[model samples]
Each structure stands twice: as structure tokens, then as C-alpha cells.
Target: MPPAYPRSPRRNGVHYANAAMTVLLGLGSNLGDRCDNMEKAIEALAGLPGTSLLRWSTVYESNALLAPDSPPMWDKPFLNAAVELSTSLKPLDLLAATQAIEKRLGRVEGERWAPRTIDVDLLAYDDETITTPELVVPHVGVRERAFVLAPLAEIVPSRRLPGTSETVLQLKRRIDDSLPAWMGVVNVTPDSFSDGGRWLKDDKPTTAQLELLDGNYIDIGGESTRPGAVDVDSETEWRRVAPVLEYLDQHFSGRLLRPKISIDTRSPTTAARAIEAGVSIVNDVSGFANRAMIEILAGSRCDLVLMHNLSVPADPSNVLPHDCDPLAVLRSWFGEHLEILERAGIARERVIIDPGIGFGKSAIQSLEIIDRARELMEFDCRVLFGHSRKSYLESMTKVPPSERDPETVAVSANLARRGVEILRVHALDLHRRFWRVYQRTA
Candidate 1:
């Protein structure tokens, strides 16, 4: 197990004197009962022991900025408002109190882009600059997010960002707030067809795993659903992934921008455990078939990657549905399954379709999905293509999985050009470097 983390600010040597300071907070909600949720949070905020509401901004409705790289689906337009308050609690404690309100209002931390009942963002704290691993005084996204600023400008138009002369209005008009999504793959199984066990250290992410996963999003898994792979029991799967989630919550708790943690498991038990441990996205190969699985997402805002799968039983023996075009079949599968999710209260905008690249595919079938992914866009949600280091690439390039970095990059570049919303990958470093180069010169 990783080292235990101190659970309190005082233990970490941060002093929150019995001092009261005026603060700015941004409130938002998109999930169930949006306005009511915001009102509930407002009431809770005013009721905080050391806090008194001074002023609030007009509520604004804006499209959710789904972070660039990982789009399980689109996000609902958020209703946002900012408020000014005087609080006697320290900054960190104030944060803790706001988070408690979020939890009380049934907001479960899942994905970075997941909608919620209420979101309380600490925009600023009495002009006191704070830069710690866990908390930054001026919320990092405040400048770039027009949703935050439009409402903030309503209350305090002349507010300045920490360490900057620009007012909120100036920063809002001058910032490029596009946050790209990067999907970093983490497999805990010993037998992933490609990089199985490569990133695991004693069933938890090693130091190397941590270094490579220092990106925007992480797709974590316990079982390897490779071709002809045997199923591990749900208990075993939960055990493997739970510790990884714990490591993320403990270690990355202090980063300025934390990766949105995702759990790539089909078992409802494992998925629920991951959700409890702060995972936001579900990469289920079973296509979220069971009500138990969908119910795990009930009342909580979580992202779902509903990939197409037929399992190892139909693995390329050509004994499967040879009747019609596979692409049409997959599209029908999406239409039917998506309707099921919608009826079950899961939004289409919160689901990304992956046409199961290697699960029951020939190299040709996988390539077809890659070449013609937008057709699957008929579901009206973002399409994700997870062809990262799969056997189909080997079928095309005849190289070992480890040596397929160039091939993987080629696929990713082509997909980006073709408008794929997200690309899942085992090696984030190579793609990240290539992306940097392309951005510099493109």
C-alpha cells in the first residue's frame, strides 16, 4: 500500500488562524433539479459556521466545456452563478465545508466533466495568494471559463485574478480556455494483449505509472478483456482497482489540475467501488448491459463509455452474424442500447460509443470502425476510438506491441484529423510529446 495521507490541514502544517476574510465562490449545477440544487447550495453556504453571504451574481446558462481529450459524451449546459461572502474559516476549511454541502446534495465525484447537483468553486480568497499541492487560492479555471466570469462579472466586474492586473472581464475576453482531453490507459491485469502488467507495481500504479499518467485523464482497469481472456470475479477485480483509486486520491490530491480518473470495469461491484473511490468515467466493454450496472450511475453524475462487444465467444471464427454489414449492425446496437440508457435516466450526452476494437473483431473490422467512425456519430454523442496498441495494429504492421508507438501515433493523428473526440492509449508520453510538436507547428 502507498503511504497514508494526513487527513487534516493542521497535520500538514497549514495554519488557518481564527481570521475572517471575504471570499468569492462560483456555484453551478446541471444534473437533477438544477436551480433547486443551486438554491440548496446557496442556503448551505450561507449557513456555514464562519460564513455570511454578502452578494451574489446573476445566474447564467452556458454549455459545459467538456475538457478536450476525454469525451465519454457531451455535457449538459450548466446554470452558473457566483457569490461574494465573508468567512472566518481558513481557505482549506472553507473548501471542505463547501464540499460537504456538495456531498449532502448528492454530488458524487466522478469525471472532471461530469455534471453535478451543485459545484462550489473557490474563485478567490481575500486577495491572499495560496499555491499548494491541494489548493490554489484563485481557482485555476476562473480566468479561462466564461461561464465562471459571466456570472462573476455580474457581482464583481472589477475583480482581479491573483498575481495579475487583469480584471475578471479582461481575463475572460483574453484567455484561451480550451482544455484538451488526454486518455492515459492503466491496466492492472497481468495479461492485457498489449501492455499488461507494464504499469502496475504490486497491483497499484508504480512510480513509473504515476509519471506517465501525469496527464488530463486516466482509464484504469483491473481485468484484461483481451481476446480469449477469462473473466475475473468481481471481488478480485474490485480489490485490484480500489487501491489504484486510493493512490490517486491520496497522491494527486494536491495537483493544480488533477486527471479525471476513470475505471474500465464491467462489474457493477467494481464500478460502484471505483465511483466511491472518486472515479468519474466508466469504460465498460459489456456495453452497460445490466440494470445493476446502470443503477450504479443512478442519482450520480458519471460518464459512460458504452463500447460494442460480443465477447471472446465470437472471436473472429466468422461464426458470428455474417448476414449484414457489421457497421450497420453496430449502429443498430447503439440505437437500441442508447434508447435503453435514455429510458433508464442516463443521458445520451453522457455516453461515448467505442466499437469494441479488439474484443470480437478481425483486423479488418477494427480498421473499418477507425476509418468510418463518424457514421457511428448517428447516435449524436461523441465517438471514441480505442485502437491503442491492440492486436489489429500488429496485424497491419507486424510489430511487437511495445514497438507499435509509431503505428499508434499514426492512428491517433489520422483519427484527430477525421474528428474522433477521444483516443485511448497505453503510452501517453509518446502521444503527448507528438501532440506538443504538432501544436507548436500545425
Candidate 2:
């Protein structure tokens, strides 16, 4: 039988100052007023001392486990959900709090898996493995049960269990291998928004740095396309990015496991040179509006990131009309360009569509792009979102460009759930840790 412990009353007007750890909890109810019981239990859990409820998954209905000759009332289906929280409480205290929640909500000491008003199980607590007579977490049955995994995967799809190697999404086994690729950003220019001029002078990017960033594609940009920026000539852009390309070609030319190199440029001349430098992808911030650029890409075997933008140096005022839908605008623009690319003999598969967040849209419009990013899947091409550390993050808060990575990560996780294929980000280490590292153990 599971441990039964009642929670003690909390001391009023006290704040927990300990370092908080993340916790995952599984909740289920099959008894009277199942929905009400689950809601009350969740509320109680949220109200626990030093525990801040993060997010919960959608409630899933599944059949209950019952013993032979069990009463008919004990055979009802269950409503299940998974919750994530940050807490300063120790593992046993957290477990006791959950058990108290179950008891207070009318659960009775009875057979295991028997129908109850509520069942709260500590699925995991910050990568800590604990096995005792009273409790075993990550909940012994979490991996094999759909009721637990289905709800948990909705929130922490890439989270790995404490004693397991496979992530929640991988154990669920629904997604293919193609999804969730990371695109590391390497800004070579002096005026770029996020890490402008950091790589200039003595801090130039090297093969070791790119390898450390660990992106499937290393996106090296020579120009700053931030709002209200000046445009450099094609030769100047090529000169700025040439050394990085040369270093990559010199070291990674014959390596079997090197990241693919992408050149971010709008100038046809720079694109030609980058192609000659053996780059595999061209990220055109100007959305290939130049006919000469289209002609150049049409003749190359490189993949193209055909992005949407109103102007090169992003005019803050050049936004879609107030009444126009942003997705519709993207569709019209992509539809026209896709046909153009096809006519130019560049296959659609070689094209990766980017909505170019914050490029020409207003803050609200940029948000709408993220909120409805999944709709871009209709284009039949991989979607790459470059929303890292942009001004749009400042719309809700007053964070500077350098301090926006946390917000960037929040949006990146949302994009991952929304099915965006690739995330072009400045903070690669943060993204990788959040996505792959279990419980921030890295």
C-alpha cells in the first residue's frame, strides 16, 4: 500500500528561501464527481507550501484498474493529468503533501489501483532517485502507462527520467527522427542585435566554438538585419563572413560528423561566394525577392531558407495592415515565391520556410506568428523559426537584447510544441540543456 501522511498546517507570512527544484506529479480520479475531485486536488497541490504549480497537461480519460469481483462503483473510468511544479520541499515532504491531498479529497485506504476520489503520485523530482519502503520515484509505472506518459509528454516531451535514458517523447515513440533540429547562430557582423561585434576583432568564431554550440547547422551571418540598420555591399558582406567559412572548410571539409554550414546573406554575390566556399544552405533574410538571388540559388544544390520580410533592415513601421492576417500574408508571399522557386528549377524540398519573426511585423503580429506557427506546416517544407533575442520580447517586459535569452527559451519550448522544425537561436547551450538535459543536471 502507498504511504498515507497528512500535511501539517503552513506557517503564515513565511517565504521559502531554499533553492527550488522542479517536480513532476501525476494525478487521477475515478470516484464521485471525478472532475471536481481532480480540480480540488490540483488546487490543493498548488496551494502547498513552497510549491509553485508550473503547468499541467490536458486531462485524459482512461479505464480504471480493478480487481476481480470489485464493486461496480470501483470500476469506473479515471480522469488523468500530469503537473509540473517548482518546489523547495524535500522529496519525502513533497510525497507526504501529495498523499495528504489524496486523503483530504476523500480517498480511503484500500487495494492498490482501486477507485478513489483522487490519486497523486510523485512522478519525478529534479533527477533525484529515491527508493525506500514507503515511496519509489519516478513512480514505478510511469513509463509503461499511457495515462501518465500521454499527459506528461504534452508538457515535458524531451524530459528524461532519473534512472532512464530515453526522453518522455522518445518513450512515447510517436515522433520521427527528423524533428527538433537546432540551428546555432554565429553573427560575424558588428551591428547584429543579440551578440553584435562579439565575434569581431580577437573573438572570431572557430571550429571548436561551432562544435561546442552543437547545432545541426551552423548559421553564420555577415550582416545585421535588425530594425533600422544599414546595408553593406555584397563584397563587404563576403569579406566579413569569408574567414569563418574558410576556417570551417579547412578543418571540417572531410569530417563525417561536422555540422552543415549556412551563410546568411541577401546579396547574390555573397551567396555565390558562400556556395563556392562549400556552404550547404543559404539563409536569405530578404526572402529571395531579388531575381538575381533566385537565379543563383536555382543553379546550386544548396538548401535555401526562404524567409519572409518586408524590408532588409526591417522597417519597424512596415507591418501588415491592421486588419490583415499575418498567416494569410505569409501564405500569399510563400505561395508566390514557391512557384517562382519551382520555375527557377529549385525543388521545393530544398527550401526551408521561415516567417522571419520581428522582421516587419508589429509586436502583436510577431506573437500571432508564434501562436499559430503550426499552420506553416501546410507549406510542405521544413519550418525554421529565428526568434532568438529579438525586440518583440521587450513588448511585454523591459529586458535588453542581451538579457532576453530566458524569454527566448520560453518561446523556443512553445515553438517545439507547435511543431516548428528548426530553431535558429543565439543561446544554443541553454536550448540544448532545456531540451535534452534531465532536470538541468548539465
Candidate 3:
């Protein structure tokens, strides 16, 4: 269990007694001025009778759901949040107060899961369950709701819900990982495992990247993180990658539709700078191990890609003796590291998990990771599959990495079938075709 957060300063009108119980509330908005509505709701909750806001979580954006009674359709993205309150009010009173705050914030009558200016649902109260016609203690579907559990974990990962053994962190990781995102590969290194020096011009990268692929997004990496590749200093890596990001940021402005940009780096300095340059993600292969890296990422607004890696090259001679379950080890590693992130206030939704296809794993282990990618959803963050043109595919196909596009595409489709969220690849044309055909079938 994680340590409890210390009591915070009290609000002007609310007095929190030492005996006050801590409660967690889920707040969200999908309609007009979402962030503003959430702020208003937080202010309202802070002054509720016998309640003081102890802490609030960083907001997370997630796909909204359509009304169950209405035809299935994708709604606007919801800005979701979690608030911890130190309160002495009865559960019913707290619930009524939150509902009143919603109405006051201009939440009008609407169908279930419909867009709202503000919505507050009582998540958990004092580890006690009140089963009644009007209320459910643990929140009817909180245990399985990733959007709710993720923000809740951000503020209080160790908190245990009433009548359940899982803590907020555990529940967050165990929640079903939904939402699919694609990532095109934009290799900028001179020695990338495949496609080395092809995109190696000092010119702007917006054109190079846009010309390379068109899909959900593109991952821009400066250094070659292939097997046995050497580490580059942060300055050198930034020099190679910053220009691309700056150009992309400028080029995408005023465009109605632009792909998301992800920066792949292991250096904390590079990650921080790339985020400052407007990259939406930092794909770190070190599983966010370094404290500086974690701190920098926590302070930035970008989503994180924490990949399981050995932090060094994989020498075939150093193979495990026997009976080592790589997947199990990776899972435990993620569980521990993710706790550290949550304890430090990193929102769980702002992360994606990568099994590290070839960072330090053997061909067999890499194959196992692909076959079992869905199992990684146990970590809750979106699972990213980066098996494009890797050595593992070459081993299976007996072709050089550059000629492994077919193998890569086949494996990607399989991973997609297994519910993987992000697919990093070089064959954008084939994937575009696949998406078109697959969407119709899906």
C-alpha cells in the first residue's frame, strides 16, 4: 500500500476535523467549456457542508460514451477528474450536494452518458458500501471504468474501495484497456535498424514525415535504439529531433486535421524539451525508471510510453538458464514502477505500455510478447505494439529487416485483433489499406 497523502490546507468556509473521513468523487465534463465547468465543480465540492477538498487529480481526456438507449455513436472527448475530500457529511448528504453542484453548473436533463456541462458521481466514501435504491457505495461500475479508476489512481492509488481487495492503483491497472491509436514510425537516426539514413536530412521533418506515412500519428525518434546501439548525449539527440518537432508544430497550425506527434527518447532532458516543442508523447524504452525522467514526464503535458527494457544490449550468450517467464517479470516491473508514478501524481490515463519488442529480449521472447500482448492490458494503459521490421520478424522470415514489411504487417493485424491500441510501423500504405478493410469488417 502507498502512503496516505498529508492533509492539505483548509478552505475559507470549510473546516476539516482530524476525525473527518476521506471520500473520493468522480467529476467529468464533455460539453461546453469542459475545463471551466470542472473547475467550478471542484470549487463547489470544496465548500460543501462538513467537506474540504484534500486533493484533486490532473484532468484526463477519454472518449465519451453515447446514451445506452440511443444508437451507438462516439461522443465528444470527456475531461475527467477525481477529487479527494475530507468530510464529516453523511454519504447521502454528499451525494445530494454534488448533484446540486452539477445542476448549478448548468447540467441540464439529458440521456444517460449524454454530453454534460458538468457531472459528478460519488465514487467511494470511507471504504463503506451503502446499497440502497438511490446509491451504490463503490459506484455501480467504478471497478471496471478505466476513465474513472485512472484519475482516482492518480490522486490515491493505495486507497481501497469498499468491499473489494483491490486498491485504486490495482483497480486502475486491471481495468479494461480500451481506445485504439495508431503511430507511424519516423526514424531520424543515421543507423536505424531498418531504413537508416533515408530520412536523414538537415531540412524540416514535417515534409519528410508527412510524405512517409499518413494515419493516426507518427513517432519521431532521434537516436537509433536498435539492439546494441550506443546511447547519445541529450544535446546531440535533441539537435537531431528538435527541428522536426518545431517544424511540425508550425506546419500543423490552422490545419483542420493533424496527426498526433510522439517523441521517442530515453533522456529526461530530451523528453522534457520535446514536450516543450509540442510533442504529444514521450516513448521511453527504460520503463520510466530514472527519477529525473519520471519527474520531467510528470511535469509535462505529454502522454508517456513506458517500455520494458533491460537498459542495455541483449547478448545472446547471456540467455537465461531456464524457466524465466519474461512476461511475468515485465508485468511485475510495470506494477512496481507504475505505483511510483501514481504516488508522484502521474495520471494513469496519460500513459501507454510497450512490451519492448527488441530492446533487450531474444527472438523467442519477442514472439511471446506479440502473442500475449493483450495480457498487458492488465496494466490498464493503452498497449503499444512496436514490432515493425524488428529482428524477431527477420528471424522468422529469413529476410533482412528492410524486407520484413510483410511479416510486420501480418503481425500488426494480429496484434490489432488482440486489442492492441497503438501500432508502430514503417508500412503506412499497407496499414492504411488494412484499416479501411478492417473497419468495414469490424
Clashes of each: 7, 0, 0
> lDDT at 293 for candidate 3?
88
In angstroms, give how far residue 62 of model 3 lies from its true place: 18
Which segments of candidate 2 are over 4 A away from where they belong?
A: 1-178, 202-213, 438-442
Residue 187, candidate 3: Cα error in Å is 1.4
Per-residue lDDT over 1-442 for candidate 1, one digit per residue giving the tens place of the 0 to 100 score: 1111112223222222223788999988888877678877876777777666665644445666678775656457677777787889888899889899999999997987877788988989998989988789798867778678756653465567778897664554454431124578878777777776776656654534565444556788888776567888998887777767777777765331245677898889888777766666788888887789988875456678998877632265542254457688788888999888888898765677888887666777778778886577555565677888777786678788877888988888767655465678867888877865664445
Per-residue CA lDDT of model 3 for 1-442, tens digit only, reads 0001223354333344443888888988988888778877887777766666676665555667655565454357787778888888888888888889999999898667667898899988887889998889889889888678766765565678888887766665554543234577877777788877766764323345456334556788888876667777898888878777767667654331245678888788898777666666788877876789888977765678888777544344444333688788879978887888888788776777788877667788888878888678776566788889887775668888888888887887788667676788888777756654564455
How far does residue 127 in candidate 2 sit from its true spot (Å)?
44
Q: Where in model 3 is the C-alpha error above 4 Å?
A: 1-179, 202-206, 313-322
The 0-to-1 C-alpha lDDT of every candidate, in the order given, reads 0.71, 0.76, 0.72
Candidate 2 lDDT over 387-432, as tens digits, reads 9988788877687898888899889888876657678988887877
Least accurate stretch of 10 residues (summed lDDT) in model 3?
Answer: 1-10
Error of 3 at 211 (Å): 3.1
